[model samples]
Target: MYRSRPGATIKAIATDLGVNPETLRNWIRAAGAGHGRGRTEGAPAVPGSSVEADLAAARKRIRDLEEERDILRKAARYFATETGW
Candidate 1:
């Protein structure tokens, strides 16, 4: 969704959508997910508090970043071994 775009701000998207910024923020917070989202086992997520789903998303992001770092490391080593001379 457009909301996930880089550098996208709440106020900007809300303006584009013809909605109040606070409302948009609430919608975003509400969408943090809950017991039925990606979590398989955890406490029942409260409506206003989506800690579980957010944690899951953060953990997945960490894994993705780690993978990207590994790829970059390999690329760096490959380029380092190549001599311009």
Candidate 2:
């Protein structure tokens, strides 16, 4: 589930799963190290591939959102000055 989300935090996930954040972090680390709960054949061998792609997409989306926010702020200032408010 955490791998599926772009900006999800460990604490948030732990809360959702009713587990401690550190516990979840440990699990993630262990999984990354190929420890605990043997991998299934269907699982992607290169986890970094999907994770990096997701990170890139999330970063791009963040940049786009920041740009939109800046534009909106500028427009608000323009309108405010135009109306002498």
Candidate 3:
């Protein structure tokens, strides 16, 4: 009901319900329906969506490096065997 009335403030709703504004704000925030409303004043910012992208890139790099290392090791072993070193 509160969500449908987009222009209604928490304070107004609280006053109408005879409840505290802060309490109503808490309810709205807990419901995740007050992201843009109420005192978002002190909430910490949500973290890196880019972190997943970075992690994926890092994983790909690691896999590539491991493959390169294995190839180099095999080459070194092959040359060692051929040269009797």
> What TM-score, computed on C-alpha atoms, does each candidate reach?
0.41, 0.48, 0.47
TM-score-sorted candidate list, best first: 2, 3, 1
TM-score of candidate 2 against the unseen true structure: 0.48
Candidate 3 segments whose C-alpha is farther than 4 A from its true place? 1-44
lDDT of 2 by residue, 15-43 (tens): 99999999988887766623543456667
Q: How does candidate 1 score on lDDT?
A: 0.68
Report the lDDT of model 1 for residue 42. 58
Question: What are the C-alpha RMSDs, in order, of all predicted structures?
Answer: 13.5, 12.1, 9.4
Candidate-wise lDDT, in order: 0.68, 0.80, 0.78
Q: Summarize candidate 1's per-residue lDDT along 1-85 as a digit string, tens digits.
A: 3334657677888898999988877766665532222323453435435677888899999999999999999888888888532
| Candidate 3 lDDT (Cα, 0 to 1) | 0.78
In model 1, where is the ten-residue run with the lowest total lDDT?
32-41
Best candidate per TM-score, number? 2
